[model samples]
Target: MEINQFLDATYLKTASQANLTEEETQQKVIELVKEAILYDYKLVMIRAIHIPLVKKILNEAKSNVLIGTVIGFHEGTYTTEEKLKEAKAAIVLGADELDFVVNYTAFKKGDLDLVRNEIIKGIKLCLDNNKVVKWILEVAALTNEEIIVISRLIKQIVFEDFGEENAKNVFVKSSTGFFKTKNNLPNGATLEVMKIISENAKPLKIKAAGGVRDYETALKMITLGVDRIGTSSSEEIIKREKNRNKGY
Candidate 1:
């Protein structure tokens, strides 16, 4: 498969971390959008606040690269109502896809009803609005068994409640890329965890985010059936692919 087709070139940094003021942050997003257009990436993932700017830039350049944003990002602690509001506002701002951080903490605490309800609401809203939806499971923060259980749960919910075709538009994504981990272990997609997710989330689509920094690893994810890859290293990965193809 063509590697760039699976890449969601990302830049989700906050203003402070990126060392940019508000205007500068928008400029950075503009640059990212330009790069995504140049590379023919599948999408450009940015924060929700920048969706309008991204839409404007892509429109002016007449680029079709999709604009994606995260809701309850980096933390899946928002209430169902709150997440729905965020989703609606994002859709209004012209976001093509919505990646939501699932309420995994509640699930771990035996609050499966709450988790289920939230995910159901979130997915329905996105589907009804004709927007792609992805649930960020934050695998780095869960146990192996938790990963399987949650992945299965997401698939079960989407397929059973919304039918298989709608489930195809819903993705079980691997990470938010900001979850703090003990010992600084990789905080994003890992092959083993992805294998577990792919095995369980069949027909629901899978997106491997975080920690996917190089061309080799990205290709491995495609081999493992990842439909989308989220990374800040899209340019580097594409550059590496070009060099390798040229036998350099």
Candidate 2:
């Protein structure tokens, strides 16, 4: 089904996280950009620091692959101002999409105002900059009910405040692929969780990130109506897709 078009080729690890030198990390990003160019994947999702490098390479290659970066990554504890500031810098650095980790901690603490405020401001900033925006809910840390509520909350905020036309530019993403869960439980998008999100957060798009590693799982996500699949295994998935097409 030409799955590369639905993939957001992702590499969001830092040097320390991967135990690599800074140069090695840059090389990884370079290879990722090259792979995206080769496959014509929808976008290459990377850390904000690498936006300029990615932008330069894509521009030189004349590749239309979009650049996406995270804001308030991993943890959603950052204040709204901080998230907005990070997003502004990403925009300035040539990011076409901004995925902000939503402040679920505040929502868990019964601080609905904090959650609402950030979503409003964050979505506004990205829309104003003509950038696609996605709110990462970090489903691993949340209960099913929380996922339903937060998804609905985001949908409501975008539809009511931003109007129907702008809702298309927003996405309700499943995870940052960085949340630590108890007992090494699945830390990314699970189909069950995705179903809840998809039903609750419509009008806005859905991006199922983390734990989506192979062609079978990725195709399932697409069949389940996810608009984008974010993963670091784009090449492997593409290989599997080729095998399936070849009846191997």
Candidate 3:
């Protein structure tokens, strides 16, 4: 397998959480971008604010690693207009892909229309700009039934509103890595969650994020038909692959 192509090296730490000043945070983003380029990862997923800096770094390095950013980030409660504006700005700054945190809270409240509207607007904006879009469902926050419902809803809406071909460019991503669970359980991609998502979201791709930190788990996700694996441990995973290749 072309493991590098399957990995989206990610670093989404903000200024405060990372305990860095704005300049320090920018430096960290640059380091992440450089690592992605050096390793030839499929993409570098960062916070939206660092898109331009990443774009500049990749351009200077003569790298083709795609640049991706998150919208509405860990929280999916942003107004649709706000999400749209963030998407537009990220694209203007050279983001090749946008991963949006879907309003699952509204969906859980039986407000499917609101959730649907936000997704439609976000997807349309990305498609119109010839960019890739992924909707993050934050599966840790949902029940099994909710996962099936929302996964099916996203696929159905994408296919019905845009043609099947356009729908192919969209992804049903699994997590945002920041969901606070009552049980304090893992809030990212798991085998069971990947199975549910893959089984429900067909034709449209799947991006497994959160908790996919090692080589073996990442390979398992790909085996389950995941199209992308988001991880901050891309280098470590790749190193493990190398060790295995050497008969270790």
Maximum-lDDT candidate: 2
Over 4 Å off in model 3, which ranges? none
Candidate 1 per-residue C-alpha lDDT over 132-240 given as tens digits, one digit per residue, 9 for 90 to 100: 9999999988998999999999999998889998867999999999889999898989999999999999889999999999999999998999999999999999999
Q: How many clashing pairs per prediction, in order?
A: 0, 0, 0
What clash pairs does model 1 have?
none
Give the lowest summed-lDDT range of ten residues in model 1. 1-10
- Could you tell me which 10 consecutive residues in candidate 2 have the lowest summed lDDT? 159-168
TM accuracy, model 1 = 0.98
TM-scores for all predictions: 0.98, 0.99, 0.98
| Candidate 1 lDDT for residue 184 | 85
Q: Write the per-residue lDDT of candidate 2 for residues 1-248, one digit (tens) a residue.
A: 99999999999999999999999999999999999999999999999999999999999999999999999998989999999999999999999999999998998888999999999999999998899999999999899999999999999998889998987899999999988888989999999999999999986899999999999999999998899999999999999999999999
Q: Highest TM-score: which candidate?
A: 2
Model 3: ten consecutive residues of lowest lDDT = 48-57
lDDT of 2 at 61: 100
